[model samples]
Target: MDDPMQTVYVWLDDEGHRTVLLFALAAALGLASVIYFVLTGEGSPTRLQLVLILAAGAVLFYVSLRSTAF
Candidate 1:
């Protein structure tokens, strides 16, 4: 039987590194969002711009989730 509260997969070396990188990227993106909001001061981003940002960030998020590549 396994401990339901603990994730065994995360203990693997590869998964651990990928998880760390994803968390780092997520933290950086969060900071950037904060800065953007602070600087822009509430002007709404255009639909095109929003779509582009989301697409690019999704790619980055996918990359960060990989175990084989950084």
Candidate 2:
């Protein structure tokens, strides 16, 4: 059986993998923000702020992936 960690390392070592990883992270953050917003009805100000921050992070990561100034 192939080692999963080794496979992951190999995949990340390939060109464009950084962009893929950033995209995945951004997607995860976006999903988390949406889920939090849906699950927490009448969320506190702090919670809302956290969700906004997560969404912002997701957008920034996605933009960075598309940027040439990596």
Candidate 3:
């Protein structure tokens, strides 16, 4: 059995590299979206656009959780 009180660090070790990459990809996508919207003068992002951004974030979150899971 594992030590119940031992803290699991998610973003502070070798496994964190994958999580960092996922977060980087999400950030890049978000930045590109903002740039495109600003240059095109789109008053608001469409539903699909928002969904895509959220999807990227969700994927990152999922990966982080999976990595930390025992």
Candidate 4:
């Protein structure tokens, strides 16, 4: 029998795990960015930027969902 670990690439997550990770990571990053902006007095992301971020998150989510499940 083949080594299952050898065949594995995605670190053993369920089908929807990637979607969860993508959204979660994006949310974490977005929150961090917001906090950083507030602390550093930097420009915050615009509404359009948030929309694009959500779009990117959705694309990542769907792509992750459609990918192989370990």
Leading candidate by lDDT: 3
Highest TM-score against the true fold, candidate: 3
Q: What's model 3's overall lDDT?
A: 0.71
CA lDDT of each candidate? 0.62, 0.70, 0.71, 0.63
Q: Candidate 2: misplaced stretches above 4 Å?
A: 1-5, 43-45, 48-52, 55-70
Considering lDDT, where higher is better, how would the candidates rank from best to worst? Answer: 3, 2, 4, 1
The residue-by-residue lDDT of candidate 3 on 1-70, one tens digit each, is 6654443443345566766777888887777767767787778887756876887778777776787565
How well is each residue in 1-70 modelled by candidate 1, as lDDT tens digits? 6775455454534666666666666667656665666687777865544654575588576765564654
Model 1 ranges off by over 4 Å: 1-13, 46-70
Worst 10 residues of 1 by lDDT: 4-13
TM-score of model number 1: 0.41
- Per-prediction TM-score: 0.41, 0.55, 0.57, 0.44
Off by over 4 Å in 3: 1-14
Error in Å for residue 34 of model 4: 0.5
By TM-score, highest first, what's the ranking?
A: 3, 2, 4, 1
Which residue pairs show collisions in model 3?
none
Between candidates 1 and 4, which one is better according to lDDT?
4
| Alpha carbon lDDT at 70, candidate 2 | 52
> Per-residue lDDT tens digits of candidate 2, residues 1-70?
8899999998987757867666677677767767776776645535664876677686776667667875
How much lDDT does candidate 4 score? 0.63
